[model samples]
Target: MDDPMQTVYVWLDDEGHRTVLLFALAAALGLASVIYFVLTGEGSPTRLQLVLILAAGAVLFYVSLRSTAF
Candidate 1:
């Protein structure tokens, strides 16, 4: 008789878990930045900086979401 088939289990390692955590953090940061930007008045260097940060966070979050590591 043939031997029973073996089973394999796949799980996320530390780096994969870290990547997921980073993605979550980036998403939260992006969302908070958008809310803050909307609440605050416009037309200032600080506002501009916040916008830049929001954009960066969005892009990073997207990349992390699409990454295979997580």
Candidate 2:
């Protein structure tokens, strides 16, 4: 039987690296946005909104880290 975890999936061949990088960049941007909001209090984002943003950032970061093949 083939091990799913061992399966390698490439995204556009060379673009796989870029995809991972993009995800990481997105995560960083999301975190930065949250920090800015918290520090400056310029924008009025509700607690739920902040939590959602943080969750999204975490998910994107995890995806980037786990995207070894793609």
- Give the best candidate by TM-score: 1
lDDT of 1 at 39: 76
lDDT of 2 by residue, 46-70 (tens): 6655775776677777775767655
How does each model score on TM-score? 0.45, 0.41
The 10-residue segment of model 2 with minimum total lDDT is 4-13
What residue pairs clash in candidate 2, if any at all? none
Give the lowest summed-lDDT range of ten residues in model 1: 2-11
Candidate 2, TM-score vs. the true structure?
0.41
lDDT of 1 by residue, 1-70 (tens): 5433421112244556656666677667666766666778665536555775777677686766678765
- Residue 8, model 1: Cα distance from true site in angstroms: 25
Per-candidate Cα lDDT values, in order, are 0.63, 0.67
In candidate 1, which residue pairs get closer than 3 Å at backbone N, Cα or C atoms, i.e. clash?
none
